[model samples]
Target: MDNYLLLKIAHSLPGLLLLLGLLAHIFMLWKANRGGDAAVLQRKLRRTRLISLPLLGVLALSLPVSGWVLVNLVGWPLGQTWLLASSVLFLAVLVLGLLLAGRLAAWQALAGSPAPASLLRFTAAYAGLIVVLLLAIMGLMGAKPA
Candidate 1:
């Protein structure tokens, strides 16, 4: 197989993995929250964070590196609007993601204590923004405008 194809696969698989891992984490959190057991919630959140966070970090790092390699291989200039937009969006996602992870870790530290309503609200909003930004990044990548 061609090196470009391999790089494309490496880049694309991580996108799917990242999305699936996030959705799974969210679902687990929702389920844990619904159970109304603080201990269970904390445990679930910690487990999800421990398992998914590293995978996410790996995926996040690999996606850009593989993409950069593919862009070079294809001879697409880095200055192209789509590429630039995607780069900026990727940075936003990375920052927001890290913040969200930190928030989750903080929540885990609370153990059986109730979370502050403000923190919960902030987390929801932050997650929503990350989702929207991710979708936008996907769109920019697919459109690849001139």
Candidate 2:
């Protein structure tokens, strides 16, 4: 296989992993939220964080490096409109993701108590932002301009 193929796979795999991880994390959170036992909810939240955080970090780091390699291999200029837009969206996603993580930490800190309604609303909003940004980035990548 060529370098482009290898790099493309490297770039794409992380995206799939990130999407699945996010979905799973959200599902776990939903389940925990629905359960009445505070101790059970806390344990599930901690477990989800422990598994998701490292995966998120790895996906976040892998994306740019692999994307840069793929861009170089294709000889696409960095200033191209699609690439520029994707980069901006990527950064936005990162910032939003960090904010969501902070919110999760705050949720975790609520240990024995139920998560506040405001915090749940914020988490859902942040998660929606991340999903929208990610989809925009995917669109840009798929519709690479001439």
Candidate 3:
């Protein structure tokens, strides 16, 4: 009904979707790789590169814009501790996301052959950190003083 409600929904929906998308990609890619069929894993990686990754990128990029608008809508000072903390965490998430993207590209490049375990490990660590940071940001957002 109101601008705040609409904006809040806009802000929240993408965050949830981004989380789910990351989890799904992790699971799907893991499954594909574990199946021990290089073609399946290659196809999965290519699909992720072509489709899911860009969608997730768009979702990730939309968050800060919506969050800024929502914060302004609520008239909350940007300097508040929780806001500051979440902002910092969001930056970390973005950085990790970029690193993860690079790793994914490397993985895709190696998809023709047997992928090395280290690349998967790094990607998993990055994704896991991103998930944890996102959850922390959600917690901070949910607990902000009214």
Candidate 4:
């Protein structure tokens, strides 16, 4: 209806998409863990991971960019130390996400063919980090610029 609404919408849309994609990736990892043939599960995992790359990138960037814009344009003053800290943490999480994503992509591509136990362990650990990051991001978002 107005500029503030537009800004809030723009920022939240990307953030929500990113959150949704993260949830999807998380579920896929869980699926991989459940009953299934190792090789087939690996193939499916790789396919899902491969497709998630661009989506992750889009979410990773869009969330912060739009969020910052909205906060700057429509949100409260950044004087709140908690909000500022959360913003920094959110950025750190995004960077880690981007870096880990590249590593995960490379690993998925290589390990997709064989599906080693070690690789699955790696996926599990990496997936764990993703979950942590998502939780932190969600917390920071809920904190907002209060």
Candidate 5:
């Protein structure tokens, strides 16, 4: 098999996993928004976290590794406009993802206590950031010049 085929497969499988995890999270949020019980939503969130943890770890590692392989081994240009824009937006999404994750943890911890009226803010933030990250994912896949 060609190395390019292998590389493409490697690039895609993890993306599918990440997309699955994101869909699961969105489902949980939808349920929560429908006034689902706190304990139920929290459990749903935990399940999503468990499903995503390994996939996300793989994503974090593959990014730099694949970028190096593409630009160095395969001699793909790092100076392309698409690559530059994608890189910038990807970094922004990554930072926001980290922040949203921390907030999710805090909200999950709060699940053990009383449900607060203020968790709506966290929910809104998480959803918004996730949408941005999802858009970043689409951008990475599309690789269109900006």
Candidate 6:
């Protein structure tokens, strides 16, 4: 009913959605790769590159804006240690996400050719790092002082 609650919901919802979307994308890509159908793999990669990735990017970008508003609403200073740590982690996630996108684009560019094992491993590792960073950020947010 209040501004804090409203802002909290706004900040939290997209974060949850983004995490879920990323996990889903990872599973989808893994499944497609395991299916051993080049056409399906390419289609999955293209769809993720063009549609899912962009939508997730928008959600990812919205988080800091909403989080800033929520923090201001709560009258918390921006320079708190947890906030700073989370910010660093968030930036790491963003950079890694972009790198992942580039790797996915390379996969898509293969146009149904079999993806290299090294490329697949690198992409998966990047995704794993992003997920870990995101989780760390969430933990920092949760552990912040009331």
**Which numbered prediction scores highest in TM-score against the true structure?**
6
In angstroms, how far off is 133's CA in candidate 1? 1.3
Q: Write the candidate numbers in order of decreasing lDDT.
A: 3, 6, 2, 1, 4, 5
14-109, model 4: which lDDT tens digit per residue? Answer: 667776777787676567656555665567667665677677676677766776676677556776765677667676666667665765665556
TM-scores, all candidates, are 0.92, 0.94, 0.96, 0.70, 0.74, 0.97
Which is better, 2 or 5, measured by lDDT?
2
**What digit string (tens of lDDT, one per residue) describes model 5 on residues 1-146?**
98866776776665556656666676666677466587777886686556564467567557656655655656667887767776776677567667666666676777656556666576567657766675676666577432
Model 3 Cα lDDT, one tens digit per residue, 1-146? 99999999999999999999999999998899889888888899888888998899899899999999999989988999999999999999999988998998999898578778898899999999999999999999999997
Prediction 2 TM-score vs. true: 0.94
As for candidate 4, its clashing pairs are none
lDDT of model 2 at position 52: 74
Error of 6 at 77 (Å): 0.9
Estimate the TM-score for candidate 3.
0.96
| Candidate 2 CA-lDDT value | 0.85
TM-score of 6: 0.97
Instruction: Report the candidate with higher lDDT, 3 versus 5.
Output: 3
RMSD of each: 1.6, 1.3, 1.0, 3.2, 3.2, 0.8
Q: Which ten residues in a row have the lowest lDDT in candidate 1?
A: 137-146
Off by over 4 Å in 3: none
Q: Please, what is the whole-model Cα lDDT of each candidate in the order they appear?
A: 0.83, 0.85, 0.92, 0.66, 0.65, 0.91
Judge candidate 3 against the unseen true structure and give its global Cα lDDT, from 0 to 1: 0.92
